[model samples]
Every structure is written in structure tokens, then in C-alpha cells.
Target: MAVELQKKGNFYMGEAPGMMEMGISNKNLDDDGRAKRTGTLITASAHIITAVIGSGVLSLAWAIAQLGWVAGPSVLIAFSGITYFTSTLLADCYRSPDPVTGKRNYTYMDVVRAHLGGIKIQLCGLAQYVNLVGITIGYTITASISMAAVKRSNCFHTHGHHTKCNVADYPFIIIFASIQIVLSQIPNFHKLSWLSILAAVMSFAYSSIGLGLSVAKVAEGSGDVRTSLTGVLVGVDVTGTEKVWKTFQAIGDIAFAYAYSTVLIEIQDTLKSSPPENKVMKKASFIGVSTTTLFYVLCGCVGYAAFGNNAPGNFLTGFGFYEPFWLIDFANVCIAIHLIGAYQVFCQPVYGFVEKWCNHRWPENGFISTEYAINIPAYGAYNINFFRVVWRTVYVIVTAVVAMIFPFFNDFLGLLGAASFWPLTVYFPIEMYIAQAKIPRFSFTWTWLKILSWACLVVSIVAAAGSVQGLATDVKAYKPFKTQGHE
Candidate 1:
């Protein structure tokens, strides 16, 4: 009469008498019966850094330039604070009834389901997946821009800076798509720690280079840095309507820069359960956000100082720093490398969602479920799924083509930020926290949270409108795949 016990979420349940005879041991499995999670603070931080410090960082200088001296830094800091707060709230939602021992919510959608459990889940999924897809597209455009910048930098050095270095972005877009097609085959988030680490390093590398060059430009008294209290004067710099749209777009760009909540739970799912995933995630968020905010302030402010009212949408690729041609080329190379890894970080969830749905929908089909073990001499035995290869390749190709069609980087980033910032980053987390914590109706805390959420909603709406206007303007003059140089 031996009693067999199996651990569930926080309780152990009695199994059938002969369960142990099946030779299954709980020692190597977690409560949910998956392989033990081995993630630590470092790995989780790497993932956050990889996701947060992405192509969005490149547009901050332009964003700052649009908002001017006071509003630029102020908005950046406010976004950082809000992101960190919402992140902490989202972290606690990683588990259910209790923060530490409750059932695990694997994805952001899972969290919404557990707490809200309605059409909200579908809304969350839509916001999240669409944002992820948008980010991948944005990254593609950015990577190609960086690639083109490298060639342009070398060209500028050879032929003068005044020479028209009209390098087409289509070829570079294809090259970036080719690189992503290979990297997208990385099975899951658990296997991306090393890649995340490398990408984080590249992010820091290019960010530092951008910062250094901006500082150099300022110190040398290089250009006419015409900064005003309010950014881009109405008539002198831009029309009144243009100023308003640029300002709103700037807000969206900053919003996009702080966006990582969509992937926070995914990152938390990788953590080892000892120190508690929520605690570890909070610390990681603090570290990641703090580090990136410091970089953002430096890059945005110094870049503004360097180029003033003429700050480029992309700090490095915008030809603002042309003298140090070699340095600029190196920075662009780092940007391309960093984005290569970042593309996977954002898109892995999308890949997982599609694969999971396919497997569930057609469980018995070998085409979707089968993984082939193909031996590669140098790389050891690898499991290759024909479906994954085809699907992911097609996905990358589609994104590449779309990027070529509309490669307006700043406007695109702003639109993505505006679209996802409120729903995915702010509203969902606050709602989940309020529901889980059981805050009383009309209570002080509840009221404040509602106000905060609504305020962000307003921000999102304005940002989206601004971005749409910018896109309309760009499209009127844009020639799809024929876009070249800094048009």
C-alpha cells in the first residue's frame, strides 16, 4: 500500500498505487512536469536588455529633437518610471492566487485569461502578436538602414560627404532577411540566452559609439545646434500642424522605446523557480530599465546637442556624424548584429503561438508534429522541422517585403509604440493587478490606477494619430521598394 504523490501547483496529489512503476520521477521535472528551468538573474536580465534596447533606441534622438530640451528628457524619464512600475505589476501576475506558489501563467495571454478571462484575452493576444510582428518589421527596416549606412559611410569617405550616396535599401533588406531566416530556426526562448547576451553586448556597443560620437560633435562645436525650449518652432522650423504631429510621434517613439512588457512573462518563464520568478523578474526589470534609461538620456540629449533642430531619425545612420567614417561604419555593423538577435527575441513568441496552434489543430499529422534529427558534422545532431523551416522562412520573407514597401523608420516605430503601449504595456497589467489584488471599488489605489490607465490611453490615441499622419505624409512621396539614401 505505498502512497504515490505528484506535485501540482502548490499541493501534492495522490496518484494511482502503481504510478511509480511507470518509472517517472518528479526529481528532474517542475510542478508542471516540464524540464527544470535553469534561468537565473543574469539570463533574465540579458533577455530584457535584448528586447528593450532595440532599434527603438536609434530613434530617440529624433524623438528628443521633436520634443525639445525640457519635454524630451522629461518624457523619456516619465516613460521609464511608468514602464518599471507596470513591469513590477506584470511580474507579480506571473503566478496566480499567490505571487510565489500559485499556478503559473506561461504567456501574457495566459495572465490575461487567469485574471480577466473574457474577450480581454483575445484582445491581449491581438495587441501582443501584432506588436511583435510590427517590431520584427521595424527591426528589418532598421537593420537594412544600418547596412546601407555602412556602405554610405565608406562612400562618404571616398567620395565627399556632399556626394549623393544613394544606396538602395532593398538589397540590404534582403540581406537582413537572409540572416534572420537562419536565426529564426532557434527552437525556443530557453535556448536563446547566449544569443541574448551577445545581442545585449552589441546594443551597448553601438549605443556607446553613438553617445561618444555625439559628445565629440558637441565638444568640437561642430554644427549649428539650434535648440529651443519648445522643440521645432512652428513657422521657422516646421508648420504648426507639423510640429504637433512630430511632438505626438515623439511621444510614441519614447513609448516604443520603453516597451518590453509583452515579453516579460516569457522572460520570467525561463527563470528557475527557487528565488521565485516574480522577485527575480522585478530585479531584472530594474536593472534592465535603469541601464537602458541611462543610455537613452545620454544618447538622446547628447545627440540633440550634436545636431540640434536637425537631429536624424536614426542617430548613426542619419549621416549626422560624417567625419569619423570608420567609427560610423563600425557602429552600423554593431547595429545590424544587435538587431539580428533582437528579431528572434521578439518573434519567438509569434513562432511559438503559430507552431502550438498548428500542432493542436492537427495533432496526428506528421508534417506539423515531426522533428527530424539531421546530423551535421561540425555542429552535432540537430532536429530540423520542415514545417518550421518553411513557415519561418516565409514569415521572414513577408516581413522583409513589407519593410521594403514602407521603410519609414521613425513613423513606423511611433505607430507601433502607440498601438501597443496602452493595451499591452499599461492597461492589461493594471487591470490584472487590480483584479488579483482585489482592490476595492472606488478605493484610493483603484481610482489612481484607473486614472493612470486612462491617461496612457490618451497618450496612445494621440501618438497613433500623429504616427498615422506622418505615415500618410511619407507615403505620398514614397516609392515603395525604390527608397534610397536619406529621402
Candidate 2:
């Protein structure tokens, strides 16, 4: 074939037989040099919700405790807007013109490598995996706690007294991780849409149940000295740097609650794209963030209203005082189910990256003998080889081991948020949007937006610093193999 040359972004491509689309199509595309787009707005919405809400929702009450009432809602709303805008920015950059294929770019790392390039892409990968593994660990810890709580609740309700029921974190972590190992074998993102939908529904169910329980506690006067809206700021120790430090911690939690940008591009790739517009992805981002924000506000505000400064980091942990044990147990079960599905959803990109690397490094492997052909009516055929069986099991084992080592719920949340939030969620999106859009930094309209982005970065840095300090302190006080909130 005759060769043609073209430039897209910072790279040049030559159009010839097996030349232009060499690296881009390595793992993502099949024989036709195209990736399957099989997601609709609904499925995309489910994935977004599944990514955005998890154990983080359970940490919002503790966030409220840190930031007080006025600041709590304010930070939540601010982070919501920031996340939605950044997510849409990510969607916009998902595709770029190709010399031969017309357009390409399927993963978040793809977008980063295209725009930022060099060591920046490596940095993005590091931040991404850190965030992903951190999220999985958090989910594992939360699932174990929820399952253990169910065991304890059953014991209390059935046996009538607090007997020695040793339902610790390790066994439940192993159980949930094993379940995740099976779920992670699903091979592709589009197939996980149904699972994501179920996860999203589960998130809403438990959130509603928790909100209802909080309201009931307040209404029945059984809650511990409930307070009004003003009570959020009242008695808060804003004296000296204590208030500043607490506010930073609150920022970290809020940022962590909204830290779904790590997987936004992968989710966008699942959308059906004839002309490859991001309109559907944008809509999905909006709907998912809006839905989660509503739940975060309801859960955080109500929990704070009920417990005030006494609210534990895990909202369910506060149920130690509430009545009607069945409701709490039911809600915990919902949380566990949601986390199981969320675990698979979030881990898909990581799984893909590792598999792609393996395929690249060892293109021919003797161990891969079995292949299952998957047929999608809209997107044609794909293959599932045996390597999935090996890698996903290992991934689950690593996560389970980590979860057992440090099951401190709120402390890990702070650490992960602080470490990855700014780099992955705030910095990359803003810089890439500015580069792709070519927004003039000197102009009045662009100046303030850039400043706002910088302000977000500054806040994230402060929060990350605070979280690091907090995590170190918690590590020193940590008791290995001990379940959080049990002792």
C-alpha cells in the first residue's frame, strides 16, 4: 500500500500496511483494528455510579465531623462540580484523529500518554494503580466489616447476649476476595454493565436505609443529643491550626468520595460510537455524580445531625447505638454486595493493563491453551484466553493480603485520597483539558478557571499532607490482624 503521513497531537504517523496503528491497537483491537463499543447511556451511568460510590459514602459522616455542617455540604458540592467538570473534560479527550483508522484512544493511560507523554504518562500509571489498589483495599476492608457486623448482629438477636463471636476481618476479607476473583474473570467492560447496575442499585438501597435509620433515631428522640443546622458549626474547635487541620482532613475525605476520574476514560470507551461523540459519556458523568452527591449529602447530613462530633468514620459503626438490628444487618449486606461488584468494575482497567503487558512481553505462552469465543451482536467477536484465570487470581490474593494487614477504615481513606486525589483527579484533568482545548492562560475568562484549578491543587496538596501525617500516626497506633471497630 502507498504510505501517507499525518500529525495528531504531538506524534506523527505513517499510513501503510501495519504501520500507523501499530502500538495503539496492540491489546484493545481485534483483527479488524477496531475496539467494540457496546455500552448505552444506562450502562455507562451504572458504571459511573459504581465507580463513584463505595465505602467512601460510608465515610461522609466522619467528613462532616471534620468540616462541620456549613463546610461539609459546601465541600461536597464543590468537589461534585469539580469532579463532573473534570470527568467531562476527560470524555472530550477520549478520541483523536488517526491517519488510517480515523480515530483512536481507548484507555485513560492512552489519553495521558498522548497528551502528556514521557515520564508524565508513567506517573499517571503509578497514580492510577495506587488509586485503584487503594480503592480495592478500602472495599475489602468495608466488606469484611459489613459481613462481620452481620454476624455479630445475628448473634445478638439470636442468642440474646453478647457471646464470643469471633467474626474478624481476615476470614471475611478472604471470602470477599475469593468472590472478587470470580467476578474479575468477566474479561471485558461492556459485559460488566449489568453487574455495575446491580451495584449502583445496591448503593442506593443501603444509602436510603441508612438515611431512614438516621431519621428514625432523630424522630424517636433516641439519637444522642441531636442538633440543628447551626449545630454543625457550634462547638467546633476552629481554634488555632486545629480547625485548619480538620478542614484539610475533611477536604481529603470529600476528594476521596469524588475520586472516580482514574477510570473515566475506560468507562467512556464502553459507549457506542459511530462518529465517536462524547455526549453520552458526558450525560453519564452528570447523572452519576448528581445521584451520588444527593446520597452523600443525605447520608452525611443526617448522620452528622444525629451524632454530631460523636459520629464514627464508618457511618454503620455509629449504628452501635441504634435499635432494630435487622435493618442494620440488611443494610450491611447491601453494602457487601455493592462492594463485590464495585471491586470488579474498578479493577477492569488494571486487569487490562497487566494482560496487555503480559501479551506484549511474552506474545506466545505455553500455558494458555483454552480460548472461549464471546459474541456480541452489536460489536462482533472477542476472545477470552486462559491467562485471565491466572492473573486475576493473583490480583485478588494481593488485595486480600493487604486488606488483612491494615483494615483501618477511615485512616486508609484519608491516605489514599491525599496521595492520589490531586495528581490523578485534579492535576491531570485540568492540565489535559487546558492542553487539548488550548485555553489561553492570559485571558480573563481562562485566567480565573486556571486559578480555580490551582486552588484545587493547593487544597489537595494540603489534604494529602494532612492525610499522610494522619496515616503515619495511625500506623504507629495500628494493631496488626485486628479488625477495625471490633476492638
Candidate 3:
């Protein structure tokens, strides 16, 4: 297998045709392939930053306000520790084989699905897809808010052209979909990587500028909202019951907001342009994941610090658009490009699964044959990578529509993702790895891993619970500004 998928004792469980071809599929993948795709230090570095940064980078101020400064970084550090241990364990399990067959390359569902089984797999798959789609929504929503904030910041609030117009939000969805559709058509990952790096760097610089300005203004007592800003910074000094209550709630909120580590899975395969079949256990497990840890810690802590209490609703857009609306729009347009790439890459698995089903139904249609049923106009039946084209379309449409209605709130999505990530990214991977290691471990090493896994399980519970609590409490509080003619 190229990435990770179902495998019987013999090894091959399934082939993710779409994802496998582009060399990013999680199934039908092996270590050697990953090792081959592994790029220079720069590419690897950018992958980590882009994967972890996402929507969370822009929403740091509001998140930190809920959690306070000291606790925010503390949670990030804790998440890194857990994420490393869990991600490594999962990667190692990927290396481990089926015990009965003694074969290695434990595919994604192949090894662990037995432990959890059919219903669980389907449920997890659904959850994973929702998380994926919802993530887009969260990002899109944050982007929309950032668009508004940036506009108002530059005094575009009164502009006639870019005025607060609410054409059906579906248009945003369709536009983003079109962007992804275009990108998915290109059968390359390297160019995309370069683009990702550019986006990551530009976003980092833009956010830093905004954060610096926000902090400076706050310090000078010219904060956007002086009283609210002070309240967030100093917090309540009152003691006794109220203080204890606030402290615990604050700590919980901080923890929930900061607890995100599984994003590694979401982006790593996208960045791995090499043949995943060749990579050894150590490189993929410890090396890749640990490297990822450093990036996340740096981006998260530095990002939160930079933005302070009034960071932009979208991290990349910063708190506001001090730049001209045209320039900002241009940036969003580029971002739309990036998002399309991401959406298609993400849509790979679902596309692959569908291909598998269709191939089975009509053996007459070869995996890559256009004889099946779908076609692209002028492009012809086989014009584009059929699977990739369809998948991107499906994802872009679904995600865009969802974003239009639901809006992607970064902190909220981050927290929810952390919660659901428990089983897939954390618990299952460690257990599967330990089981594969097979060394009887009452000893320190064995005991520690078991302990770590258990602790991660507990933390996942906490994160999920806290996330729900925060969402229930705060979700309804936000209201979109009225668009033109809506009032």
C-alpha cells in the first residue's frame, strides 16, 4: 500500500486509486514511498507549519483571551507532548504488520479495524469526513470574518463596491469549489508544496505585522476596545469562590482551545511527495512527527503571543485589513487557490473509496478507464483524472455550502477537532503500536508507553468534553454583521 489502508494478512486490503496515483493516498501506501517523497529540510519545515497553522493562527487573540496567556502556551506544550507520542505510535503501527500473517505495513484500517470492527470503522470514517468538511467550514467562516474585519480596519466599511453585500453565501462556496476544481486537475504535488510554503510565509508575516500593531496600540491605551482589552489582560483579581470558579473555567477553556495535535495526519501525506513505501520506521515515526512537534509549538505559541487579545478573526488576514480592499481581496483569492488544493487533496480518500465501489460494480471499467460513466466537457471522458475531478467537485461544493451556512470558527473547530481526534490520532495508534512492539513491558519503557497512551485517552476525553462545553456556551454568542439589504 502507498499510504495506509485496509490490509488482510497478505498485506493489500485496498487501493486508493485517486490518492495513490498522486502519491498522497493514506491507503495502498508503504514506508518506502513516504521516504522517497520526503523533501529537503525546507519543504519538510513548510509542511509542518502549514499543517498546524491553518485557521488557528488567525484567531489567537480571542482564544487567548478566553484562556489567558500563561495557560495558553502551557496547553500547547502539553498538546505537543501528547501529539508526538501518539503520532509516533500511529506511524510505528503503520510499520508493524498483521500478527497472523507476520507481514508489515499495517494499513490504516487493516490493522486497527479488527480491534474496533465494521460499525466503528464506518462511524469513524463518517466522523473523520465531517471533521474534514467542518474544518473547511471553520476556515471559510474565519476567512469571511477576517474579510470583514480587514475591510473595516482599512476604512472600507463605507466603500460602495466591496460594501457589506450578502449575495447568497453559496456563491462563495461555488467560487472556492471552482478554485479547487482547477487545482485538482493538475496532477502535481511539488508545485503545490511551493505554493503552500509561500502562503504559509506570507500569512506568517502578515499576522506578525497585525499582532505587533494590535499589541502596540493596546499598550498605548488606544486599543480597539480599551476597557474590554484591559479586562482580558488583567482578568479579575477577586478571590474566594468566584476566583476559584473563574480559574478552573479559564483553565478548561484554555486547555480546550489549545488542544489540537492530530492535524499531522491531515497534512503530512499531502506534503510527502516521495514514495511512502521505502521509508524506515524511525524516519516516519519519530523524525517526522517530532519535527512536526517543534513547528506546532513554535507556530502556536509565537502566533498567540503575537496577536495578543485582539488578533484578527482569521489569523492570516490579521485583525483588520489595513491594506487596500483590492489587495486584501487579491490575497483571499490566492487563499482560495490554496484552499482548493487542500480540499482536493483531502477529498482523495472519499474519491478513492467511490472508485473502488464503482470498479467492483462494473469490472468492464478499468480503474483508470473512462468507460465507467463520468466525463468532463471538452476535456472529454478521460480528460482529467476522473476520480480527482469528481472528488474535488464534491468536496468543494459540500465544504462551500457548509461554510456559507455554518461559518468556520477557528477556535471552535480546533477544539472540536481535538476532541474527535482522540481515537483516530491518539489512543488507537499507541495501543496498536504497543501491541505490535510485542515486548512484554512491565519494564519502564513498556510501562511508560502504556501510561502515556492511557493519559492521552484521558486527555482526549477532557478535550472533547471541554470543547462541547465551550461550544454550547459560546457558539450562539457570535452574530454575523448585517450584509447590504439584509437589514
Candidate 4:
């Protein structure tokens, strides 16, 4: 008798007798001999939406208020166009040599390693993982703010609007962290489709709620709404320097909102290979980016029209919409739910990277490489790894603690967006595309791409500086772990 073997990661397992007769065959598997990926355009779009339409949307009104009527919409549109274009380029890089028929690149770092190896791989990993970590921390802070807002909203309704419904954010941060710790145990990106779908729905719910509330406020003509062609007035609304810094920060906010590119390759990897992953991913990117841009413009413009220069950093949680307390609470709850899924979508890659490294470095170690199957009621047998459990829990805790320390939502978002926008979103994609396409140096196409990359780099620098300045100013008044929310 002959033995049949199946490869699983770096190890091999003996095939059960008559497995082929039991309807398990290579025909049902992908080219890589793994389970065939069933993800389609819709799932990819859902993942993109879940990743893109996160806490960043809450800060748009404030961003638009800083830029005003003209530049606000214009900049938002510009980002949409740029992001969609660059995203198409990135989608093509999911395969090496020949995109349609070539071998697949499973991660963003893999894509980099294939096209532009050497130190570039390290640089790409650092930028990507660091941005992902920053985003998770931001999500933690934002989720806690929304949770606190829910409590504060009910308090305002029970009491009066003028009452100082001061709520400490620490408790909510712990609560959010606790939930993430549980959800983080769900393994990898392939298993998160259901969660992403639910989260995408939640994102739409909250974003629509914010947009509707803003439109209602505008129509009712209740607030002292103001409008300007050039945005906030220099002397009346802010100092000249303040205006400049805020304008740059506003750019960062918009840039951050459009930043799903960091995870493009990872998302693309989940798609079935039939129609070409690049083709499906490109279409998904268009749909996702377009949908989010529409929501962003409506929310940012209408919210600004309602609050003008006085727009809150977070319209829902910043007490911009105080009446209809239940609706406010519901919207905040939706935000919290959305962030929970968004956090996992961003953090899974980091988790995967570390776990892969550990497993490779200690292939023979049981602690790092072993998995135990545990049976649970209502849920079938599940594989558990002690190392994964420990590491992911610690990761969640660190992010929660950091969120408690610096909860300056707007400034922190601006900084993360600025620091990541150019390298991860703009620079790497262009460089990879150029290298893979073998475009002639100094040619028109190469020249324009280089120019665009450099221009975005400059934008990132200014935006980061402004965000740092804002953080410095905020830190002077903020005490770590003692921040209070007032409605």
C-alpha cells in the first residue's frame, strides 16, 4: 500500500484512506492546493467598506470646516480619484511578472518582496504594520468615545441639555478592549466575512444617520450655520498660523479616510482566482471608493453647512446632535459596532505576520507551532493555539492602554493618515507598478508617476507637522486616563 500526503503550511499530513472517494480532490482546490477562495466582488467590497468607512468618517465635517466650501469638496473628490487610480495599480500587483497568469502574492509585503526586494521589503513592512497598529489604537479610542456618548446621550435626555453630563472614557475603553480580545480569537481574514458584512452594514447605518441628521439640521435652520468660499476665517475663526496648520491637518483627515490601500493585497488574496483577482479587485475598489466618497461628501458638506467653523471633531460623539437622544445613542452604538469589525480587519495582517514569523523561527517548538482541538456546545470542534491567545490578548490590551493615554481623536487621526498616506498608499504602489511594468526612465508615464509620488510625499510631511502641533497643544490640557466627555 502507498501513502498519500497533503501539504499544510510548512508541514505535511497523511491523507485519510479513501479521501478522494469521499469527494475531496484537487479539482475542488485552488492552484495552490488550498481550499478554493469563494470571495467575490461583493465580499471584497464589503471588506473594503468595512476597512475604509471607519472612525475617519466622523472627523470629515471638522476637516471640511477647516477647508471651507470650495476646497472641501474639491479635496475630497481629488482624494477619491487618486485613491481609485492607485488602487487599480495595486490590484494588478497581486500577481508577479504577468498579473493575469503569474503566481500570486499573498500579502502586501509579499508583493513588495516580489517586485522591489531588498530593504524596501523591510520599509514596506514597517510602514504597513505601524499604520495598522496606529489605526487599531485609533479605533479603540473612537469606539470608547462612541460608547461614552451613548451613556452621555441618555443622561442629557433624562436631565437637560445644559447639564454637564461628564462621563469618564476609561471604563468604556476597557469595555471595548474586552470585546476585541474575544473577537480577536477568531483566527484569520478568511473567517471574518460575516463580521465584515455586519460591520459594513453598521457603517452604512451610522454614516446615513449622520448624513440625515445633518440634512435635517440644515433644513430646520436651527443652528447658526455659516458658509465661506475659502473656509474658516483667519482672524475671526482662527489665527493665521492656526488656519494653515488646520488646513494641512484637514488634508490628512481626508487622506486617512481614503486609506484602504494598505490592505489591498491582503483583501485581494481572499478572492477566487477564476476571473483574475486583479480584475475583481479593481471593480471592488471602484465600487467601494465611490460609495464611501458619496457618503463622505454628503456628510462633510451638510455637517459643515449645519455647524460651519464650529463643527465638532466627531459630530455624533462630540455633541453636535443632542436632540433625539435615542437616535444619537443608536448612531453611537452603530459606530462602536463598526469600529469593532474595522479593528479586526486592520489588525489581522499584523497578527498573521507575527504568528508566521514565530512558527517559522520555532518550527519544532510545541508552544508556538502546535494547535489543540477543543469541542464546544453549539459550536463544533475548534482549533486553539495558546500562543495566539496570549499574543492577541496582549496586543489588544496595549492598544487600549494607549487609547486611554492620548485620546485626541482628530489630531491623532491626522497624524496616522499623514504618516501612512504617502509611503503605503501613494509611493509604494507607484514604485511597484513602475518596476513591474518596466517603464522607461524619464518617460512621460514614469515622470508623471514620480512627480505624483513626490507631491504626495510633500503633502504628507506638512500634514504630519500640523497634526503633531495639534497634539502638542492638546497634550498641554489633557491628563492621561482622566479624560471626561461632556455633552
Per-model TM-score, in order, reads 0.94, 0.85, 0.67, 0.95
What is the clash tally of candidate 3?
40
Task: Give a tens-digit lDDT track for model 4, residues 1-487.
Answer: 2222221253211111133343668777677655568899999999999999998899999999999899999999988998999999999898998999988888899999999999999999999999999999999989999998998889889998888887889999999999999999987788889999999999999999999999988889954777798888999989999999999989998999988887888889889988999999999999999999999999999999988888888899989989899999999999999999999999989888898777667766777666666777898766677778999999999999998888889898999999999998899899999999999999999999999999989989999999999989888877564444411
lDDT of 2 at 265: 82
**Model 3: residue 248 alpha-carbon error in angstroms:** 9.7
Task: List the candidate 3 regions with Cα displacement exceeding 4 Å.
Answer: 1-45, 98-107, 110-127, 146-170, 186-195, 211-338, 365-388, 439-447, 469-487
lDDT (C-alpha) at residue 96 in model 4: 91
What does candidate 3's lDDT look like per residue over 232-266, in tens digits? 44444333543333333333333333222333333
Tens-digit per-residue lDDT, 198-260, candidate 2: 999999888888888778766767545544443334345345455556567767878888878
Per-residue accuracy of model 1 over 104-193 as CA lDDT, tens digit each: 988899899999998999999999999999999999999999999998889889999898877889999999999899988887888899
- lDDT order, best first, reads 4, 1, 2, 3
lDDT values for all models: 0.87, 0.74, 0.47, 0.87
Error of 1 at 1 (Å): 45
Q: Residue 343's C-alpha lDDT in candidate 3?
A: 44
**C-alpha RMSD values across all candidates:** 5.4, 6.8, 7.6, 3.7
